[model samples]
Target: MELDKMDENEWRYHGEGNKSLVVSHVQLSIVLRLLKYPAEDSENPPQTVEQAFRQVQNIVDFSSNVMSCLLGEKFVHSGEVVKLPLEFVRQLSIKVQHQRPAWRCDKVMDIYSGCALCLPNLTSPTLHQPTHTPTLCIEIKPKCGFLPYSKHVSQDIKTKVCRFCMHQHYKVAMGTWKRRSRYCPLDLFSGNRQRMHFAIRQLIDEPQNNLKIFKGGRCIFSSMDGIEDSMDLNSLLHHLRPYFQYGNNRINSHMTSKALLTDFIQVVVNALLSAGGGDGGVGTDRRGEGRSFCEASLFNKERSRHGSQGSPSDSVLYRVRQTQMLDTLDIEGLYPLYRRVEQHLQDFPKERTRLQMDGPYNEAFLEKLHKCPSEDDGSLEYAVSKVHQYRVAMTAKDSQIMVALVPSCEEEEDDEGLPGQRQHRDFLSSRPPAFSYSVSILDLDPKPFDNIPRQLRLDQNIVSCYLRSSCALP
Candidate 1:
């Protein structure tokens, strides 16, 4: 049985084509470079296999370096040497011998390069033997039962076909069976399917600690699909679990208050949608969001003074804290939601639309007045109201939401004595209020900010007032 028999003729042709040859050359060159060979020889002619291999290696090394610079520090692991299979070498030797009469050295090099690139993913542990053996080996005779005889259909051909083993006879003559079903020593005693299944089970049961193991490894006996799916899902859940817990935690951690968590989630969702243009670089999407989420949580430890009289003006910082929390908690949902929202916006009407308020306390509202449709039902109004409600709820529980928003000495204390418990001496030492302002939201026309800055300012002022008033209430 031949390898070509198993794969489609087109794929086999592609594997033997010029592109495959170039990739092979690049791969071979990379391997040679890894072995510390002097790849360039200005004085030497390029006829020899050794010289050609060296030249290819040099090109691959140069390409790898360029790619590394453009991408990052470790875009390509150039040092790793890939071993060629003895069977591949043998096949190349046969082709070289057959084509030697007509093909020039350069043509042969091209073929060699293509063969290298076309080599399937290597199985591990790679045969590390010093002798360069072909990855596959086969022996053939004209009289062999599996060999194609005549173009005409005849009774003698049937007898000859049956003489060879059932697998090889049917596959070689008809070209319709497991092509790799060779009469090799390995295949003779062992069933390939059983061996493959065992290998896959072992890999599944005992996966590699490092994910890089999958690179250039054999697919046979490896539950790569299953493992990859599980890993990705696990990663998604692991990053998102904390945000949900933080949002729901009754005794909130200083760095991840409920209000801040909600804000962080909103920012993350917005960032995923590429909405509200901002330098969201580190907090932009899944990968960036993860990094920013962790960093923000760490930074909030210092900013969330954790106790004492809250500072209301530190709302901006509080909002930042919320953005951080949201980025971490809803990262999983953010990507999916962003995709859904983008699709929704594309399909949603551009004409006049209505707003609907629903959900917890009927506080959530949809604001379709914006140029684009909202991705999620929660609009700016609902978001602001949610933040205000969260703040009020925390305050009512005797927790200082303002203190958690700002960095201050007084806010650092874990416990502030009850109203009647504080000594008169302590009261005397307290400083006077620095400044104050009320916050609320006001309705304004949905027009671009370019024409009416004053209107926008008023609208903003109204929104702040509304939020502050909502926070102030029972």
Candidate 2:
């Protein structure tokens, strides 16, 4: 395909992360994900053309071959690696510069590297929706779902408190976040519909880094860089009401803001709960309250019991919770193993990059992990094996769940009847809503082998700070 003729201007900034910038093609159902790196850093310089190609190729292959096996294959897409002209990359970078969040400008797009990842625009409204049918895409960064049950976990607090909750204190102390978000991963991971709804409500209340609302593949609401000014509820509701009201004229005319917002949140909740394939039988009429972040502790035995028992074995959240259990040794035990692996790798550097494109764990290794070892088999081989499993689990923990909702076009509206009024009633009979939805897992990048030590230190800091603060007291 002649990518140059597509007009660099057609590519608009979609969203970004610490490592890459994603831009969507206006007229096409695709997006180009570009890598990002330091501007003048000597240690981490721009990759050469060959290196850049291999890097993106590695990502594609790893996501396709490895992550797909861990997460469901239907939810994971390993897009093709496309090499753009350097000039085209440069212009596209410049064009989207103004659209990026201010704080995210630190690491600019790799203008020197021509390689880009071409992915299907999962949230594309033009391709996925009928005319005047607005599409709502909810991006949820559901952090680690389960607390450490490993005996090797030195800190009793780590066993009692989830990593995401403890990290909130650290974030607040660092001034990186304006305040602590009440959204707990445990609550979201809890299979109970009420708890899940409550968790999503908390996210909507304070989106900070974890939740984002997109309309037509463009970010309409998010707490960009954890800024205080981005928490405008009125703006979020305004953007959401249009999509909810577009077809059902009767509901649109009479729907209050409260009802509209509830319906919107229900759509997202329905998508998440239905991950196992049912119509997510959760109701949206009555709002469910939940324990505060401070009160929502894993130490609460009743809460923990419900989480373990209430969750569906086949659901996506259940799968993630199970994947998270790979860290059976926790970071405490994983650290020693990590050091051993590092030393061994240094001793035999030749084995460091074997099957590198397949990510840290191979299919055989992953299958063994899925079997769940019965004992704390402490050996160099065991450590090596579990470390890879731990890394894969970490990737799953940091991944985002993209829930896309578009009005279903299966039934044709009667020619003599109102546009969508008659169809809206038919759509809401027994299911959550008339909308057709899709759920996909995103951000499947492999964590570096060396990040284990950094995690250990961060875990220490988070636990220490939380204990020192007043929030730690039960």
Candidate 3:
């Protein structure tokens, strides 16, 4: 008998006895990486399989402990399964599926087994009569792990809320709003005046969205329209101030409020332009009618008196930049970023009344102020190019990281140079020396090997016996 072939009990006992057989440290590290757990030096490391299993048990125990703490109830362990009292399993299952498919599978299997094995024992009925006992069977299959226990709860609570808040806070601190929003904290609310003031200073110090709008295809306005655009333009300017205030309130201050505001405004303007027309014109301009009206309206009797004698009669030339294609692309990119920013702003906390006052606001802060949409560049090609470049860089980085993480393979092969040399020598030596062609070998035709059908012969024997039986009966 093969020594490797062991009984179930023997295998189980052997596996239990060997502490190293339960889990490998490398496997544990892989699991941690898959789970995205932060690496800490103090964390226990697994060297053997048993140690690994113990570590897994510890994880399960911790999970159970957390559940107990949150639910205020001890988990009842029946056999192999530890029934979770809390309703977070469904949500946990979704997180696991997204982040740790393998760990989730193993964990679920362990829990199910624990539940089954931990059941309380009870006496059976008579031998002839069957005892009606509740049997809880947990099936462990590769595909079965995807089944979510609490689907309704998982779908109800939005998981992106916290992430949105964090991102919004970062943007607000960085003052990216100079290009993004319509109102600042000073204009919107009165509380935390100092905070907002300080934030504005920080935003002015680090203005990122200045060139971003030009890249985003904002249209530059003539000096005349620039004056008329001040009303709506100031609205966006005001909206960005609060984000600057909030961002400056943070400790690290990685982002400035103006940058966040700029990013946001770019999104809004792009959206407005997208919805109104491909050129970001609000529907006021229908075909050429609106343009004609604006031109005619601007060149009224009084304005015409100021013009030179007989300047093209009454026809007014409306100079609208041809940006239909560029506007479409800008809007497409702007909408997603806008939605993300909006979601983040919506989730931001409303606790702080006003921003704190920090450094003095100077020319730098004033310089950070972005020109309104009217002053934007005509094309968004630069922005599009930047986006594409960022995506390419990220893809390259991911590929490099994956390559580095994966193990390399090595294999041996025969020396082709030596084989080629041997072949060359044999050909050179045998060229004219082996010219003896044998007639006997040329006339030889090998016999074909016969393959008999064993099944056919057996059938023939059965047929003969059947015929003999049939004749005797007749």
Clash tally, candidates in order: 35, 0, 76
Put down candidate 1 lDDT per residue, 24-64, tens digits, no spaces. Answer: 22122111111111124223433455544443443344223
Q: Per lDDT, what order, best first?
A: 2, 1, 3
**lDDT assessment of candidate 1:** 0.24
Model 3 Cα lDDT, one tens digit per residue, 206-245: 3222111110011111111122332243443453333233
lDDT of 1 at 73: 21
TM-score to native of every candidate shown: 0.17, 0.85, 0.14
lDDT measured at residue 147 in model 3 versus the true structure, 0 to 100:
12
Query: lDDT: which candidate is best?
Result: 2
Per-residue alpha-carbon lDDT of model 2 for 1-474, expressed as tens digits? 476565787778788898899989877768989889865542455668788777788778667877777666656767889978878887888898887888887787887768889987767523224445666778899998877767788877776677888899899999988889888887787666667777888898888889987777777778874433346888878777655664464554756788777777776766665643433443321111232223444334455444333355545666666666667788888888888777877888765665131343446545545554555576556666777788888988888888777765556543222332111112222233466666677788778777889999898999899888845566
Candidate maximizing TM-score = 2
Candidate 3 off by > 4 Å: 1-54, 72-74, 78-130, 133-474
- Stretches of candidate 2 off by over 4 Å are 4-6, 42-46, 125-131, 225-230, 245-252, 276-308, 355-378, 409-432, 471-474
